[model samples]
Target: MSKTSLSLALATALAGIVSMPAAIAGTPSGAFSIFKNCPYTNPSVTTCLYNVVSSGSFVIGNTTLPITSPITLQGGLESVGPSPLYDAVGAPTLASVPAKVPGGLLGIANPAPDWPFPLWVAFWSIVNSVNDVTATIELVDTVQTNFLQALYPPAPDSGEDPVAARLTVRVHLQNPFLGGTCYIGSPQNPIRINLQTATTNPPPPNQPISGEPGNSYYVWVDEANYVGYIQDDDNSLVDNSFAVPGASGCGNVALGLPIITSVLDFLVSGAVNLKVGLPSAAGKNTAIMSGDTSLAASAYVLASEQ
Candidate 1:
């Protein structure tokens, strides 16, 4: 082939290479999300509890909960509180708290009298930054009871009662800039959500309750981070976000009350060596400042992994 023809062929190959699709970017460090299957299980009653606990870590920006370098398990279920609807029934009427369940296990049980009413567990984590997130969830039925036991001694039970239930996991990426404001707009609010019901064990006719065994659900967010931004000028604003004063600064801030608010003034100005923005800053920060800030507890569940 002539030199001119060879040059033309090379140019064509270069053009094709340039037109190739660009590679997807990786999730930044310190940003992560959760994962699980729908219709979770009661850790105390299910044998597959290990599956939920063993799934994986929460990934934030570039730092992942349960870090790898030092093998630190930094993040886990802080506190699985009752769903908002259940909270209205009063704390005493709610299901038993999963105090016994370890941080690793994402399951819990409802004590007696409650009859295991459907509940929602809140989970939170703080990485270095924020990013878009995705999650995985799984559900499995593990136990069943005799629905007719109330009528007769043995109830002359028949086949297993069908266990039908769905799992709904909602993920909220709190923005520290908006004073821990939750990512709320329309559909982008929840980072991950899975709704599912048990497909097996069809309910018996005229039966008020299905005597099917309990089921376990697992949901996880493999990738997560912050993409939106707020216009503000406050370096103390965490993560380059806003630095809300008091508890109303960010909508998603999850700092519990009483302790933090009690000593706000003292910690911030008194002889204490308080530094704003730091995790410990909670104790010293004032909970009375202005701007848009919601109590941390109202925003995300930021507590010990128990």
Candidate 2:
């Protein structure tokens, strides 16, 4: 089985242990609950979308993090065609959801041989409390015009897909040892993921990978809404050309202690970056987001709330 599959299969086992909270919670009542986060209130917002990334893998440097938990992206678009070039939502649209990375630090499960002995002592001391490490992908910023590409992707040139979405994001590495502020990238220097629906054209070392637009369909929330049908369905976004920055602020909390906090921070950050290949260059990393998407008129979504 794939790492994602295996992680899912073994998720129950981790349940007995302390695990991170599930992603995308609190479903509101109504058929359009899936699009609950849609910005229907914005008069300029005409299109709303809801996407659930089911299974995929994110490789940063040397560490391979499988997406066992689903990550959701939802919001609305002011214009379909980039003519006007409206944003998805005035506020951040991408949900800050955590996808647990199996095997904790160094991809090693707890209670391993010589647990907390020798070199494993510092490693286990930090992550032991969290049970497992969780990586949360949070959006830092994005181009408003890129939203249209997800719906009407441009044709591929040669064999490579055109850029679909330009997303600037940071990965939050959460564990008791790393503390609450540990992160791979920050808002000022974020990882930019330029996604496409067709075959990718990576830099070097990495090979080209393909993605699908998936099937498209329409849905009518209510016949009385008198709005155009929602154009939405499944799609896959792939990118292997983005770079990943080194982690920072790890083990810099009160938990890391006072005098040795700086040392712990330096040790934890250095170990993680070295082991995971921090500051990975473009073409050395990969991200595949496979999920279903729905697009509905803001009026239709607003009407559904009634």
Candidate 3:
């Protein structure tokens, strides 16, 4: 069959399980409580509000208010409760160095606070006011792992290590809003992002071959990963209007890119195949596998409806 004919047949077969729909913005239930001239102090009050938002519940007080969007909170909001906990935005630099080694066995880095996970809820401004809002919450990783591994490879036996690997999660908001972007820090580590391996670099034999010398190994993280979210706590909820040209959500008032959460990983080994998996709350978890070679790797946001 011709390439076009083959492509058409394949698409028809896949249509049973896959559906293509345009992204839709989420609507708020008319149950939010509004206070007039109320001071935003009281940790208990904030905690209550956070619980309502997180639990998908709401209570509106005596006021003539229109529920423009769902009440939402990002990172964490402080409340009146004793010893209130907060969510962390970006990954903080390691006060001390983690374990390091040469080729063969390898250690995957821990997830950064800013690294996008499955359960993260992203918010964007629709009215520019703190009250007017839109939210894009994701409970799963949308990026595919196989695609990422194909694009960037991990370490190789006696080969160079990956310079870096990054994952970015974006939330598209439909309205314009001011002071609507907020980040939360988790009191307990609530998210898990990790990499798993299939084959490790082979260890040297007790006795070296007469002609072959024992190989040495080393791993190095990409400088970009270090600067992107690790070294800099520059987590931001950017306006869609200011997105890079020719990129997603540019010059479109109907859509705004609020949160950009990312993570980077570096590895050193001779192994040809490696797989990485992000923490998930539902569906078949996704994974990326590095076939062979040593180079930078990356995964974009997993696209899904709220």
Candidate 4:
């Protein structure tokens, strides 16, 4: 088959499971989000080198978003390795630094008010905003469009496609390990993204800003096994447009996860495979993660509407 025919065929096969007239994007069409760890070609070599790069498409009514590629124009699953988090503030000196997180992350309980998981905001494609950074308020990590494409003769698909609405969740957080100086204290910790893995603790409680409260904080012990958490303090679930972009009418747009899970794992899957999370941290969760950020630990992927 020619490249054009092969592209159409691939699009059909993928979208075939979701709706009809697969190649064309139509009412309630499907949208995709892909994360890849490509350091050689990505722009943010500092972050991209260590972090997962993201890209996807929005299947608007009747017309699939035009994919840009020299090869066939059809989205395909990614096959890349997962990257680690890092600090982006190494400018004027070096590139970036490793985040200083706490150690012994086995089965930690709710370590709230100190280090709450952040809502990872992202978009399938930039519609109104100039870039994802400005539009989503979340620091841009991986940026790409038409992120995936297929060649003629076709190939088998890899990765698992889980249910998602249109949301982004960044389980990584900023907190002081011991107390003194907070490593991820900087707003939007562009310096480093420390998780539950550090050689030493921060210091003690009550040093100043970024100090650990009660000389303690919270973190995901085993994100890979621990499902997820949607607690009361996590304000990211609420619909407050004034606070979050594209969240004006979306009241309490958040994902309900059971037993605080690791955002690292989620990002790992989203980045390595041809999958995406609904109500992306930057997108609206009017349907899925809507209402309150408070919910018992649960495992559910609110699929988007067709």
Candidate number of the best lDDT: 2
The candidate maximizing TM-score is: 2
The Cα error of candidate 3 at residue 177, in Å, is 3.8
Indicate the residue-level lDDT of 107 in model 1. Answer: 15
Instruction: Name the runs in model 1 displaced over 4 angstroms.
Output: 1-88, 92-163, 166-169, 184-306
Which parts of model 2 are misplaced by more than 4 Å?
A: 1-30, 83-92, 108-122, 126-131, 143-148, 158-161, 222-228, 256-262
Q: Per-residue lDDT for 164 in model 4?
A: 14
Query: Between prediction 3 and prediction 4, which has the larger TM-score?
Result: 4
The TM-score between candidate 3 and the true structure equals 0.15
lDDT of prediction 3 = 0.19
TM-score of each: 0.17, 0.76, 0.15, 0.16
Q: Global lDDT of each model?
A: 0.19, 0.64, 0.19, 0.20
lDDT of 3 by residue, 77-169 (tens): 132112222331232111111111111111111223453332122211221223232323221222112211212233355363321211222
Model 2 / residue 43 / CA error / Å:
2.2
Off by over 4 Å in 4: 1-23, 30-137, 143-189, 194-306
Task: Judge candidate 1 at residue 180 and give its lDDT.
Answer: 29
